[model samples]
Target: MTRLAYSALSSYSRVQIMRLVQDHPGRTITDLCDETGLHANTVREHVQRLIEGGYLVAETERRTTRGRPRVLYSAATGEAAASSPIARRKAEEAARRGDLMRRVLPWTADAELPSDALHQIDALVEDLGDAGFDPIIDEGALTVDLSPCPHASADGSHRDVLCAVHQGLMEGVLTQAGGPLRIAQITTSCDPSTCVVMLRR
Candidate 1:
């Protein structure tokens, strides 16, 4: 941990909140409150301190519905990855990959492909690769192996939390891409070593 990171995470609540943000970035204040079991006022106070100290940064997301835009907070710690050029490159690649998936999924869903099996599998490979899952697809594309996970170490509560988030991201992409298709679940299983996502047509 950097001096700044250590200094900022000194408090128990701050550390808890920071860890939560690290696992789930772009979380709103209400999301943080629900996840951390912290009151909104208390979360806001701590979030303000984190922002001033450069441990976190806030972003304004455009509202999809008729309401005010929401503010999302993410970790801004200048840790090892933040300082390294290689790490930044990976992050950039991951962002582009994710964006591509977001763009392609809806279109894929709209394409009305004859082989949903093949097309969907192709999309998953591209999507997971761009997200830095380091994906390995078996011969039939029936099984996938994601080694060197996008996450550091999946342990404790985080193991389940991160896996669920990953699953949700993929599922969300599918839902957004395919308007009327209501296949809500993606079969995803993972351990600290690897994550395996099974695709069914």
Candidate 2:
């Protein structure tokens, strides 16, 4: 295969490995082979690729028995593959927004909301409101809901416009927060003339 095709395939494999690691951290090569239904060799190949790509790291841990230690694999720390200029720009923007949230929100204090998700949603709503969005805070698996100005629309596709805006908004906000924001769900739909954004942070 060409270099480009190999790179694409490697990238896909890396993403698959990352997802597996996210779901089951500290998994072994045998575990991956079982989960992915691939041959042990194939699993090893993919895992090695991920390690070489700087997307994964491995450590050896000794079991309680008298046998030798087994190698355990896990996802790497720090950001990965911000290769393109646009992606780098987005990362920078997200970092700036996270800094703003750190300064404005009571991140240190445990929020009084019913749950952690609600607390994050509330924080997001407050931050968006402070940033001048007409937001409606909702409590659910997905945290904050938004209803930006309907009159601000130039075209009739208010839902699409609002979805894009809020997607950008959430990306910026979470990027600034400096960690992976566990987004359980995100649903964007239209409500009459206005667009509604439902998110779980």
lDDT of each: 0.54, 0.49
Off by over 4 Å in 1: 1-28, 37-119, 139-141, 179-191
Candidate 2 residue-wise lDDT, 1-201, digit = tens: 111211312233444555676556678988887777788887888877655533356778868889888888865433342122322333444345545665688463334433333334443554455444566654333345445443344445543433343354354334333343544445544543344555433
Tens digit per residue, CA lDDT, model 1, 16-35 = 67667767778899998998
Q: In model 2, what are the clashing residue pairs, if there are any?
A: 94-175, 94-176, 98-176, 98-177, 142-199, 142-200, 143-199, 143-200, 143-201
lDDT of 2 at 42: 78
Give the lowest summed-lDDT range of ten residues in model 2.
1-10
Each prediction's TM-score against the native? 0.41, 0.38
- Roughly what TM-score does model 2 have, to 2 decimal places? 0.38
